[model samples]
Target chain A: MSEKNKSDMLRAPFKLEYDYERSTGPIIGKFFEGLSNQQILGTKNGDNVYVPAAEFDPITYEHLSEFVELPETGTVKSFTWIDQPRKHHLINKPFAFALIQIDGATSSILHMITNCNESDIEVGSRVKVSWSEEKTETIKDISHFELINE
Target chain B: MSEEKKDHFISPISLDYNYTAGAATTRFLKKVSEGKIVGQKCPKCTAVYVPPRGSCPRCGVATEEEVELVDKGSVESFTIVHIPIPGNPIVPPYVCAMIRLEGANISFLHLIQEIDLKDIRIGMRVEAVWKDKSEWDTTLENIKWFKPSGGDDIDPSEYRFKGPE
Candidate 1:
């Protein structure tokens, strides 16, 4: 019956974490394998090249097999800037989640752009892949992107 | 590139969150820091909830009256944990119990200490073994664990969930 109702509440930062073994199957696995060697790959749908190889054609719904290697450089088509990142985010500093279209590829892939200010980036900003020092054969192999100073 | 193609990937996911203990439970924790245990008494069914969460589940009524309880209880049920918990100082094969405190209708979970794993049985008497008074804070964790109190074993059925008969 103290005046100060000071008791510890369960309001604290908590981290729920787990590691799961996931099967990449065939098509997606090949793309990850290419990332391990610092290569970017896409699947061809007629005249268009789709980055992050699609397993089946969107229009025809047929299995597409042709793989095309593309450049790591890309242009940010759409993005949302994170002024303040949370603890779970891979990049602790300010960054942007971007939909980037790789040069010569008709489709875009989702990735992060870091090490820049808000004024340094805009829609259609030229960026290049910033590879992680360690390779895990996953999308994280391409850790993030940086604005190309061209 | 080398020959092998990858088949499997280990995906590690980490989620951050905030957990808040609402009103009634907050009052209970404050009592615990002062070296007392308390619960909220339901207005409708009159069932006492330890570490009270404000509302009664059976009657769906607010439990406003606070009922203070002694730091003693009986083990309604218990499990001896064999697997080691990450970042826990306790060794394997410790006893975790569902303790039904005296004056409370419901049971709450806490660790049991100062006894062998085999000797632990249902209906056994136990008392809260709290941390030093200086270390006490507004948390259920004020009670470090529970220990045997050398009292006669109460009937297990006494602490069983009370429902409409």
Candidate 2:
């Protein structure tokens, strides 16, 4: 601990751990259950159907229980390319995180687009769900979306 | 917005990080390892900050001049915590005080014990109670807590003399 080298430092390891436990309730709980079975479900609000099922109508705010089975296919409405994957990313290689407009649905689902290069995907590119072989009743059941055209 | 209420989702979230102390803070903690307390003086505002963050948060100037401090201090404020901290051995109803160490401009939180809960007050005189020398390390935890030292309590105005907000 000399004066000349007092500034030379060591970093201490810090871990913040806690249990994130809560009830997903009915609407979101049913949505996750649908994913485990490889089913795409949405809620019908008049003419517009929202994927990831909204519990209430967007306009009238009425309780919505009428569910619709949507097709797995979708079109990329907007997207951003990631050249390098970070530790927490699901995909190990370069991928695109795109806002997809699922077919027969009014809104978009933010999902990953993999197995394609930077120029191979765009706003209008068609893609479909690539299901994980091991489903966990969570969002990851849809492993990622793949280019339906290429 | 009410929905169907059932089914529990229990997920454990955790993050591992490395916090490297800055030059000023590293030196301050090192001093605490040797049964001493230190503060860094800000060049612009001239405020002495204990456990310095290497810069003046108010004046936005670098702090390098180090000032060795006495272990004695005054309780600037205090609160009795009735709720127990998870995994902690200390029982609730214990006093946690904001202590401004002698020669330090800012107050820091620390446990105040060895006195009755009713006796705790603002501007009370207290001194650091250190653990055994062999168990010391580069941690402020080396000074276990502050205890009533039976001296003149600092004038309440002394701690309230900081420049304008």
Candidate 3:
């Protein structure tokens, strides 16, 4: 048993490619359809209405269907710096990923932060939706999240 | 049961992927239809790759030459797929293995046959049993399975490779 032969037995390399198709259920369907119409929809959970219509009530885990519209401008509740990105992420470069709570909405949506440096970003920062010139049914149609000056 | 008893509905969704072929794998699959085993040799490292490969991981260079390998090989590792993956073409309870064939430096993954799950030994020798000539295709299914290579259980250390039974 030579060391060279042992190494070969241990780690044999192979490559595999797989194709995956995900079914967007009714909840996500309505949200994407709303985005296509240039209108944002939210779900009403008791007294609070949330944007990007929540799939289920966070507390009760109930299917939420009540819909409402909210202003595009929002406040950043929490944020993180994504230095190294993975495939299908919103942005490729080092950018801040933020949780934005739009006005008239209780819950928030996760999106990327843009046009601001690491020094400028804070948890309580104000942000606005910079919609894309080419609108699509996908979430990226919102373009990039812009930092709104206080 | 009245006139309004028509309460049945069904829906079905099917998807197909136009899979692209890689360099060495394309050649390997082509040979399988002709009932042959093929391998690729690394130009820099000199290690032979079964089921072929585009590049040598060690040398980081494209494998240039095509080489024919022995249909017989020793199992390196194997798993029984008891559960069926949805939309998989093959039936369940099939054995998939990484076999270290003679003359090839690396192993290739394929199915093994003519042996039971309990009788399978890690160091047991096995030979490729090809499918009927009429049933050959550009797929790994051409080699039905590796059966006992006509030898009794030998010392694991004496054998060059110890594949999963």
Candidate 4:
């Protein structure tokens, strides 16, 4: 096609935005507040203890109200090494997003694992949450999980 | 109750979308960029739609027949926006009107300019004003605005589509 003909084609930027705000309700609200105070919390339903505080019991379909304080140290349930990181990823360097089961919690939470080589971490590896210096009651408060040598 | 109120947090969100104009819309926009208006006619109801909707909304059938329409049309309804909203394209006190193009049964909403707000009426005749040829593109933005067509006042009954009986 000619240059002038191609120039005739139209293009414009469009953005879809919500003008309103969203409120994180009670269960998830407490989870965020705990992160702000450098604490980790979980919700308990009978025998199953969920880290990151589930709003309802996944198996029972009942409202979960019991809050369990969990230790920062956890074992990696499963992990995958990312060779190249995308722009949206929290860490620019190669890292792993792993399912980590915290101490005293039966269920695992998905979070980034860093501060170690791809070969140094695997299933059942011990890791601890590296809290961010600046916390604002969001998931980013827990910067990433680092390998516990001991 | 007080603890619940203190724990609540507000989250702000924004999103972006890119829509690919399908075959029917592409054809309609191309014609409009060339300073011509076209509509798709419903085979079942014979109702013509400006901006060429691919399907007939009234009959739930695909529209295939293309019909050229006149630039002049009558305003079916309108609202004057006075509230100042963030990122609003037009200023307050501007008129946004639903115009039923001549020979088309359906109405499309667009900005009505070059007329006083107090003088605007439901059946006021308006014509599409094209932008400079250099700025023309395969988009509806080619039409700068709809101005008064200087035609006689059209009765509401004349532009109203009586259902397919």
Chain B TM, every candidate: 0.88, 0.87, 0.74, 0.86
Two-way DockQ contest, 2 vs 4, winner: 2
Pitting candidate 2 against candidate 4, the one with the higher TM-score is 2
Candidate 3 C-alpha error for residue B162, in Å: 16
> Compared with the true structure, what per-residue lDDT tens digits does model 4 show for residues B64-108?
999999888889999988997777778888988998888889889
Docking class of 1: medium
Chain A only, candidate 4, TM-score: 0.86
Tens digits of per-residue lDDT for model 2, B121-148? 9999999999999999999899888999
True contacts kept of 1: 0.91
Per model, how much of the real contact set is kept?
Answer: 0.91, 0.89, 0.00, 0.47
lDDT of 1 by residue, B21-88 (tens): 66677777778879988888888778889979889998998889989988998999999999986668
Question: What residue pairs are clashing in model 3?
Answer: B75-B163, B76-B163, B113-B145
Write out the backbone clash pairs for model 1. Answer: A8-B138
lDDT of 2 by residue, A1-150 (tens): 476664477569998877776666677777777888999988897898988788887778999888889988999999999999997788999999999988998988999999999999989999999999997777778999999864
Give the TM-scores of the predictions, in the order they appear.
0.70, 0.75, 0.50, 0.67
Query: Candidate 1, after superposition: displacement of residue B97 in Å?
Result: 2.1
C-alpha-based local distance difference test score of model 2: 0.86
Residue A146 lDDT (model 4): 95
Least accurate stretch of 10 residues (summed lDDT) in model 3 chain A? A6-15
Best by lDDT: 1
> In model 1 chain B, where is the ten-residue run with the lowest total lDDT?
B156-165
Compared with the true structure, what per-residue lDDT tens digits does model 1 show for residues A27-104? 788899889999998889888887888888876788888999999899999999999998778899999999999998
